[model samples]
Target: MKVSIKREFDFIEYEVDMSDATLLEILHEIKTNQENSLAYSSGCRSSVCGSCAVRVNEKEVLACSYKVQDGDRVEPLKNVEIIRDLVVNMDKALETNARAKSWLAEFNKETVLNHEDEKINALQSDCILCGSCYSACPVYAVNEEFLGPFSLTGVWKYVSDKRELNAAQKIETIQTNGVWDCTLCNECTLVCPQGISSKADIEKLRMKSSMAGYSDPNFGQSFGGGFGFDGTPSF
Candidate 1:
């Protein structure tokens, strides 16, 4: 199989003997046998650890989980600093996750949730923080600080927590670069290996926002509005 890895300055192509192999396996093979300097990141070979996310044909995918094929254009995830071939600096992604306070920050220690809430949060809690959503995000292409899908999904998880005290603060934190900014394009959902639909989760957050009396920041300042043909009811 032949694949190309994006270097800082150029694309490097390699041919390996494996007919059916995972991208990670091919990467390791190339690194071990072909180029000792080849670098990539991986923790759990399974999809549980998101550390091995990269772009295959301009689409974000977990390298360990994605099957490699001929003429695959392998590259590092977008909107992140490339540390080396197919490796990116994920430290900022982790920091944003923390800054979003994706976890419960101030729930009563003794409080317990019902089974439904627990089940929902548990499904959300499977996030491996792999940053595949960040790479798949279109918002990141324009605004780097726009807390990408993973962080927003995390926010949604906690915002839905039964013991949460300040859902308002969580909503507000997500209002600007968080949920409202998402184009709802479903790109993040398509790429997530965990099968967690960050886009759908974000839409839920938007519904929660509307219930909270929050509106889009760009609500009524467009050309269509000034022309008196805006979509709003003529109240």
Candidate 2:
């Protein structure tokens, strides 16, 4: 099997006699035996920590879970600053959560746990912060200010939290580079290792925003004329 690893200046390929091995194992073998300068990130090797994320053949996947194949091209996650080899600086993508204030606001401490709220936010809470969705998100590439999928999913989680007391402010924060900025390409959902649907979470956030009396700002750009802000087509 031949594995191609993207480096700072170019791509390097290594041939190994192997089959049915995980990419992380292959990377370790390559680093230990072949190249001593290979760099990548992994933790919890069980796919729970989400640190073993990388692009296998241009598709985002968890290295711990994804099996290696013959002639596989491995690259770092896109839309992030690469520090070395497959290791990328994830701070830019993670900063969106702090900027968007996706964390839970001052909520009622005495609020009782709601099963329905737990059910609603269960999937969003499963995010391991691997940043695969952010890499797949085109909006994050073009608009750095645009909150990426994981952060948006975080916002949606807090919005649906029974203890949250500041839902209105959260809604306001996402209006600009938040939900409306998403292209709805579903790439984030496709690349998620946790099977958490950030796309669905964003959709729920949009619906929540609509309930809060907000709409997509660029809605009329498609219609140009005779269309309304409410998105109703006029004869």
Candidate 3:
């Protein structure tokens, strides 16, 4: 099968024998025999580590699990600095967690979650930090500072926990470049490898924000200067 990998300035094409081989395997073959300088990242080839994520034909996928196909155009994850070949610098994307304060603020000593309570944020805990959602998110195209889907999901994870004491503060942290900034495009949800619905989590966060008397900052701007007090349209 023929595969094309994107480099810094160009796409390099290669031909390899791909008999039910995963993309990671294809990369290995190319690196071992064809180009000793080829660079990519991988660990826990079973798709557990999430370190081998790459984009295949504009779709985010784990290289360790995705089977290679003919004429596949492989590229590094988008919206981040590329280190080399398929390797990208994930520092900025990962930093969103800290910026959104997505960790437990304070523990409620008396709070013990039942099975039902645990289910509230169970799916969110499955995130492997693959950054697929980050790659697929459109917000970074315009506003790189916008707290992303995974970060918002992480916030939801802790906020939904009955043991967390500062849920309201967590909600407040996401009010700006956080929840309201999301375009609700659902691209993040579609690319998530763990099947976690970040879109739904974000929507729940929006509801929580509303309940806490917070509103979308863009709401007023979207309706600015159109109405008159005399019940007539202002031109």
Candidate 4:
């Protein structure tokens, strides 16, 4: 099988003797035998660590789990600085968590979650921080500061918690580059390896925002006479 990997400014193609192999395995073979300088990241080859994530043919996937095929074009994730071949600096993507304050603030009390309550944010808790959603998000193409999917999903996880006393504050924090900025295109949900729907979580956040008397900041610009449409009957 022949695979092409993006190295800095170029895509270097390599031939692999093995046919049935994971992308990570192919990368290992290439790095070990073909090119010693080939660089990629991997851990917990079982897809648990989420460190081996890369883009295959423009789709985000875990290299540890995805089986490579002939003529596969492997590239590093988007929307972040690429430290090297297939290795990106995740610090910027992770910074959104702190910027969005996706953690529990002002805990109400020591409350144990019942089975029902736990299910509220259960799917969201499974995020591996692989940054696949971050790559898939289109908002970053124009607005890099817009908090991406994983962070928003993390926000949902804490905001939904019954014990979190500052849900309103959390909602307020995401109003600018936070929740309202998301286009609801569902690209982030499609790329998440954990099956976590950041789109759904973001929608829930929007609902929560409405309940807290917050609306999209662009709501006025898009409506309410800001669009040059006066309250006149044009029919």
Top-scoring candidate (lDDT): 3
Score every model by TM-score: 0.90, 0.92, 0.94, 0.93
Clashing pairs in 2: none
For model 2, state the Cα shift of residue 50 in Å.
1.5
* Candidate 4 deviant stretches above 4 angstroms: 224-235
Per-residue alpha-carbon lDDT of model 4 for 1-235, expressed as tens digits?
A: 8899999899888998997899998999998999999999998998788999899999999999999989999999998899999999999899999999999988877887899999999999999999999998889767889998999999999999999988878987888788888999999889888999999999999898877766665665567655534322122
Tens-digit per-residue lDDT, 1-235, candidate 3: 9999998888999999768999999999999999989999999998788999999999999999999899999999999899999999999999999999989989888887899998988999999999999999999767889999999999999989989988989998898898888989999889888999999999999998878777776774666723322222123
Q: What is candidate 2's lDDT per residue for 1-235, written digit by digit as tens?
A: 9999999878899998778999999999999999989999998999899888999999999999999998899999999999999999999889999978988878998988877767878878889999999999998899888898999999989988979999989988888888888889999999999888888889998998888777776885665634556532223
Candidate 4 TM-score, true structure as reference? 0.93
Task: Give the alpha-carbon lDDT of every model.
Answer: 0.83, 0.88, 0.89, 0.89
lDDT of candidate 4 vs native?
Answer: 0.89
User: Ten consecutive residues with minimal summed lDDT in candidate 1?
Assistant: 226-235
Error of 3 at 202 (Å): 0.4
